[model samples]
Target: MHNPRSDKPVLVGVESLDNVQQLVRTAGDLADLGAGTVRVVTVAVKRSDSPFRVFSDETIVREFADSSHELLDRATTPEGVTIERDVLVARSAARGLLAAVEETDPAALVVGWRPQEQRTDAVFGTTVDALVERAPCDLYVERVGHEANGVDSILLPVAGGPHVETAARAAIAIAARNDARVLVFSVETSGDAAALAAEGREALAGVDGPEVPVETTVRESDDVTGAIVDEAAAHDVVVMGATRKGSLRRKLVGSVPRRVVDQTDRTVILARSGDVVGGPLHELGRLLRRW
Candidate 1:
């Protein structure tokens, strides 16, 4: 079932100006869908006090806030979408972003993923890893692709999961903004392919948003990740839900989504429903694993 469109602003967390246009654009579109604003936020790490330091903490924060505003100024926000900018000071990027989520109470939190080459050890990255388990709002982790010049077409792969509805809504919101078409594709290895196809169609049908053309397709493939990766080549963007896994396993993007993000160059948006929050012990375990 589709939930009502949230009127809360969409919050986008950025580390730098690099590739932030796509993120801001996506968040702007999502905000436009709900008649809300887009708040672009960047975190400034608070450095420890040193007697020999050249600049004071206040000076450092001022410089960082200036850079943050410059970054926001560079972002090409969608027309008719209100945009706000902020620079948060915290011990780490993850802490700053989590604090922003708590203060803003946004409907969705948008973040970017570094390419595999840039990050080899963590699943997504340090900040994203922490937010994946703790963010209190829906999460959209974008892996921007060079080929995704425009949102002319969207590839949305669905399987029954808590996040399918959110993914569908996101796809539709983007499609509506770009006047693009959505292809709701599903892969089934066995047992009632037609049923799964029907469910895919229903997922799109239930989304409440601007009218956009949507098509559903089901293909039988022994390799779900390979199928998604191959089909993703035909579209400009791929929007899919996190895998259906328990909370601990959910700390990382499901294996399929992780592989798809790794394999495909198409701009991928991995959506996760925010209904589940990991407890303190689980959070501690994840931190230890990362260390």
Candidate 2:
């Protein structure tokens, strides 16, 4: 499942100072997994012409680029990994990031996320959500905090779906570089626990995390999200797949990943399988709901 030819750059979308360290760590992880260049990108709001305009747009853009470079320079780059800095100005952060993705065509887009009390504006609830829906390549959203420090132990939540297989590949790629342990966690609400556990193990057996040890467990729980949150508390990172089911409205309001980001302290990476699905109206409604 690992692409030997995927030597493309890994683009990281960094927002604030709070997430810079986390984003840097993520870019390093990706670089270890055969990705060549690590591009760190930040977006600034595009100012429109107005009577109150004080500074020229060119000056503002230069200042923003300079600030972004300064902040990214604080990050430590891994060996063999080239760090590239990008400053994008658009109507919003999400639009700016999407434009970058289009230009770069990266192997994956790494973004940082933190729980917000309220986000009343934006199309995808937040920039991360919007990028998830629109990004051309695979997406990895890292939840930033004290819990997202290291990659010693990694968790891969699987459900025996196509996305699960994709997620397993992602886990193997990431674990290979860090020598991290892979814990294949699954929840059994209706089926046999033993069967689910077996299936989880089989899904990960082909991709053995590049010599990294992998363990599988299937627990019975009515609240899947709650179970994931509890398990994540014990692990450093939880790598899961992009959600396929659920209404656009629900995805906008609150999806499994969103819930996990809000409730869990551990870092998360939502892996996509490059499959095109529909739900633009759902996204549009959610964006409109904020107004």
Candidate 3:
């Protein structure tokens, strides 16, 4: 099925000018595919209400707004994509981004991630961690990598889930923009590998978007994560669905997408569809994590 949010704008939350090109480019491609606009946003922390301050809160906000505009100016937006810029003030970046989602109601929220030493205690960094649970729209987390002159191939690993369609659509959009090819890949631990491959092909067939060269591959591997990481070495970008497991399980065991992001040097875009299935129990788990 086609993404229901395709007609809405894409909201991108950028932390800094560094490594923001990929984030903006990805957002632009998605927006371009949907014939929508891209809203690039940054958050400025509101100054504390202390009695003593050298600069007024208004002055601080003005400075931040200027810097934000400069950062937005430096972004390399995709061709044929409409772009908008904004600066939001909130106590925290996560809160500011969540607020933007509420106000703008974008089709999806795109953010950038820089690889760091994996923390056993965290799923993603602070801002992303908050959005994973609370954001009302689809989420795209791009793991920034070394600059690439162009994109010629996209690796899309699918295992059949709510987010598969979203991932496929993103991969197809990016491929259309760059004249690249997409490989719909799957790893079967047991059962029939042929059936798994067929399933992957079907998933790609269901996505509606600009036509692009597409291929499907299925392999038998006991190590799903390793298989994906190895295949990613040959591709410029990897687009895959976020784990369907509950948040608590992901926190403890780590998801395949998370592992692939950590192990691969290639840029990875993890897509999570907004049709969250976990009911009240899932919400309770998220709340407990906050405490």
- Top lDDT hit: 1
Which pairs clash (backbone N, Cα, C closer than 3 Å) in model 2?
none
For candidate 3, the lDDT comes to: 0.77
RMSD of 2: 4.6
Model 3, TM vs. native: 0.86
Query: After aligning candidate 2 to the native by TM-score, how far in Å is the CA of 34 from where it should be?
Result: 2.4
* Error of model 3, residue 12, in angstroms: 0.8
Error of 1 at 282 (Å): 8.6
Structural similarity to truth (TM-score) of each candidate: 0.87, 0.80, 0.86
Deviation (Å) of 104 in candidate 3: 0.8
What's the ranking of the predictions by TM-score, best on top?
1, 3, 2
Clashing pairs in 1: none
Between prediction 1 and prediction 3, the one with superior TM-score is 1
| Best-performing candidate as measured by TM-score | 1
All models: lDDT? 0.80, 0.69, 0.77
Query: How do the residues 236-269 of candidate 1 rate in per-residue lDDT, one tens digit apiece?
Result: 9999988875455444368789889888888899
